[model samples]
Target chain A: MLELGPIFRALLRNKIGAILIAVQIAFTMAIIVNAVFIIYDRSQQTKRPSGIDEANTFYINSSGFGDDFDIKGTITRDLEAIRALPGVIDAVQINAIPISGSGWSMGLQTEAGAEHDGQGVAVYMVDEHGIKALDLELLAGENFAKSDIRWRGPAGSKWPAKVIVTEAMAKRLFPELSYSEAVGKTVYINNDEPMIITGIIDKLQAPWVGWDNLDNAMLSPEKMEFQSTRYLIRTVPGMRDQLMKTVEELLAENKSRVIDGMRSIDYVRERSYRGNTAMIKILTTVIVTLTVVTSLGIVGLASFSVNRRKKQIGIRRALGATKASILRYFMVENFLISASGVVLGAALTIALNMLLVSALSIPPLDWFYIPAGMLVLCLVGQAAVFGPAKKATEIAPATATRTV
Target chain B: MLTMTNVKKVFRTDLVETHALRDFNLQVDEGEFVAVTGPSGSGKTTFLNIAGMLETFNEGTYQLDGEDVSHLNDNQRSKLRNEKIGFIFQSYNLIPDLSLFDNVDVPLRYRGFDAKERKKRIEESLDIVGLANRMKHLPSQLSGGQQQRVAIARALAGNPRFLLADEPTGNLDSAMAQSVMELLKEINKKGTTIVMVTHDPQLATQATRNIFVKDGQVSEINDVVAMHVANG
Candidate 1:
């Protein structure tokens, strides 16, 4: 171990450059630690299971071109033709799929016109085949029977009295009861319409994955015939792409209706989280740039110090200090500076994480990242100072002593 | 004790090759205080550097303390230097950021001495230079004479077999120079060999022996007291 007193004294003599590099290290640590945490969180979120067969599924949105055409009849015919496609397994018309970032959301209340605001929940309208088509597991309850299915108009004039809810939504409405007990419970929508929960799914996510309550979703047995209708079709394994084109062409044959959009659920999900992916890219770029800049700063200051102390180094060499000793002196000095920076950076990291937590409601940064960040910065600092320290060792005691 | 036989040193640039030391030969016995004097660019400093093992000769043999060091690698030479040789410079060469004690501690640290031993040597060396109370003072805080004394303390801290001082008092006043000379004489009396290079003839007369260099070669050697008696 080196004697740190002399190194500290030397650094104190040149405090300005040392402080600047320290501050750079501190900010780099804070930004990188937090950025990495957020990126990891977002990446995990994107990979979360939507409780559906996403790989084998695609969605088609259609709208009739003319008013004289029967919207319900046209949707029925298009769904029939799509279901008959060779590779298609099952098809159902849904208002939206999870992770699309846009859908219908309403509140759920145990009693109508309660004084307190109700818990908000995403509302998905599907038919009797909606559960099987989306591959949702029925947990502690039965699937919706055909007699429970009903047609709901655009204004929701025809509302379903029976509804299927995810286990998360069930727990939210009746937190005092178990999953089985929450079944057959009455829930009010929009503070007026009463609906009874008839089935419970193990898991289903809301359209917006960033929502505070991502899993609070409910399924209604409504044959929704909107001006623009979305059909969620699940295909046999490894057959989605081939069937997507065939289905689109068959749906477009009517000529009275146009295929507004046709995309795999995977593509829709990716588009939904595009903002997060872009954020990761940008944060990664900033991290790389900051690390490079901080390293260069350390190299620049260390080189300057080495150049200014050439005579001193020569004197030390002449005094029987080996080349390794001279090199170690400089390295020890840099380590002192880097250690100071890391200590300050650890505090800064916590402060920055607290601010982000309060402002953005993100989870607090994990404590492990602090030491991990410090380790990286210290390694970078040492690596950056190595070149200048090596140069100091090359100073000849004879030549430098003669410089006077 | 030090010996050099037909040592040749050449400095080369793209356009010229300069022979800094050509067929240089010298030897100094143990416990002798020798002063070397020469005109500017006469290679006295070059010879001192080679003698200290701070520079390697292009050709020839050098033995320090009866060890053949002519073809030793850098690390081996460094080990030998650390074990046996100490150096002092014209400018004192004290690190400005270090206290006097730290300055003395440098070579001891390189020598891998324990802290207690290093502290004892540092204190004793500083007391020899009469700066024991000022161990905490930085080099920049000391006067030229005081700083040079601290340099001497640093050189003595390792208990080197011999000292190679190049113009040890070159940057001091006459009174300071005389004081430093007395200190060197006292150290020499204790049986430590010293080879000092200086341009002052008065200081040269104080040494037991003196050598003059010209054009990278020793032109003459004299016993200063004998020469004075012979002149009388």
Candidate 2:
């Protein structure tokens, strides 16, 4: 502790250089820590919007010539062939898939002759097996069956406005209605007569890294009469890709419906979040590089400053300073300067984070960056001190006797 | 005790090689006060530096307190110098920003002594130099004589084997120089070997013995060395 006074005094003797080094440290830390925070935010959001049971699901898009323009039967035949493939998992053909390239938007009103005040939620006209293939749970009603098509109108029928809604959308449609109350109530979509809200399915969270994902409402194909360009498939473990290929070939062989290439639900979800994830990667790289450079600069400048004090170090040596002691003296001085810089940087990162929030759609600060910034600074100080402190220790006491 | 026999130091540059000491020899036992004097570039400073283990000679064995320091590393030399040598320079070399007490405390801190022990030694040594009450003063605040005294206090705090001074009184006025000389004589009487190098013939006369070097070689001249000391 007694040794600290002189080391500290020596560092303080050059206040400008010390403060500048600290500033460099702080600046790099701000970028580095925030970059980490941004990556964490990306991960959370990527996993946030997923809805499908990613492990069990795959999506097949069929887009080509159908028999004299009958895309639905063409789609249905391909779906059947895919289901029959080896490692056969249950599969279904649906008119509309969630987050599909095509979806219809219309007003959904909950009472008779209502003026269609609110727009309808995304509605997938699916079969019983499709819901099961998706692992969707019915919150207040039974799952769809192939038999339900007899009770409902044609696919894409101007239904009396009833469709499933997410738990969140249900709350929005009826402020006081509980999830149970929203069920069995008649809602009008596109100002047509009201359709009953059959069942609410849970919202989906997509994966961070693809294209086969849906996160909204599903309805019986009997209610919505219009068919869609999407086909959803579920295959047994490891067979989904092969089955997808077979389905495409079948669609081509039948000449009734066109078959699109195969992709898992994982692919769609990954695609959904790729933009943000890539951004995070780029930003983190930039911040890390900046931090490393800043730390190196601090170390280099500190070494130079300590070198300039060689004669003083020599005087101290002749005054009975052990070489190790002198080495420590220089090292401690560098650490002190670095610590001050880190503190300043932490404060600045907070301030800069506020500015970033307003300027762009950036994620919030993450937890990992704080320690990473400090570690970078420490390594910088230790590395830089090697040169200057070694030079400092090598100063011969004989220098003190000579005329400087 | 300090002893050197056949001490040879050669300085070499890329273009020129110069031998500063050619077969030099000197010996001083415990409590001996010896002064080294010579004309400009006479190797007085080099010999004194070698004696203090601050510099090593090229081709001779120099012993300080019965140890051969010829092959020791820098750290080893630093430790030996710290534990056994006191240095007083013409410039005083007090860290201007520090208080007298802190200056005295500097070397002791490097010795790895505890705070209490270092403080006690600093106080005692400051008192011995009659600067106990002024320990709080800065070197810049003190007169030249007082600053040199603080430098001595700092050196003495190490309890060194000997004091190697390069023109200890060179920067002082006549009275201040006399006072510093008296302090050195008193310090020598207390059993610390003192080897002083000086250009001042008058001040050089106060040592118990004097050695004159001409052209990197020492020659003992009994009558001439005495006359030089006696005239002052």
In order, what lDDT does every prediction score? 0.88, 0.72
- What TM value does model 1 have? 0.95
lDDT of 2 by residue, A1-404 (tens): 43677667656656888888888888877876776677777676576644656655666655554335654455556566766777656766655444334454455555546544764456556666655666666677656555555323243344523356666556657779887788887766656566677777776321212222233354644422223355676667777767666766765675544445456767765666668779888987897688667756766786687667666676887776777877887778888888888878878887777777778656556645666667776667677767777777878877777667
CAPRI-style docking class of model 2 based on DockQ: acceptable
Angstrom error at residue A189, model 1: 3.4
Tens digits of per-residue lDDT for model 2 on B57-131? 799888889998889887788788889999998889887657788889888887878988988999999999999
- Give me the runs in candidate 1 sitting further than 4 Å from their true place: A65-68, A109-113, A157-159, A174-181, A192-194, B228-232
Which regions in candidate 2 have their CA more than 4 angstroms from the true location? A44-68, A85-125, A131-143, A149-203, A206-224, A235-246, A252-270, A353-376, B10-18, B57-59, B67-76, B96-99, B123-147, B170-179, B214-216, B221-232
Candidate that scores best on lDDT: 1
Model 1 C-alpha RMSD vs. true structure (Å) is 2.1
Interface RMSD of each: 1.6, 2.1
DockQ for all models: 0.65, 0.48
**Per-residue accuracy of model 1 over B1-232 as CA lDDT, tens digit each:** 7888998999999999988888888899999999999998889889988888889889988989998898888778887887898788888888888889888998888888989999999999999999999998888888999999998988888888998888999999999999999999999999889999999988998998999988888889998768878987
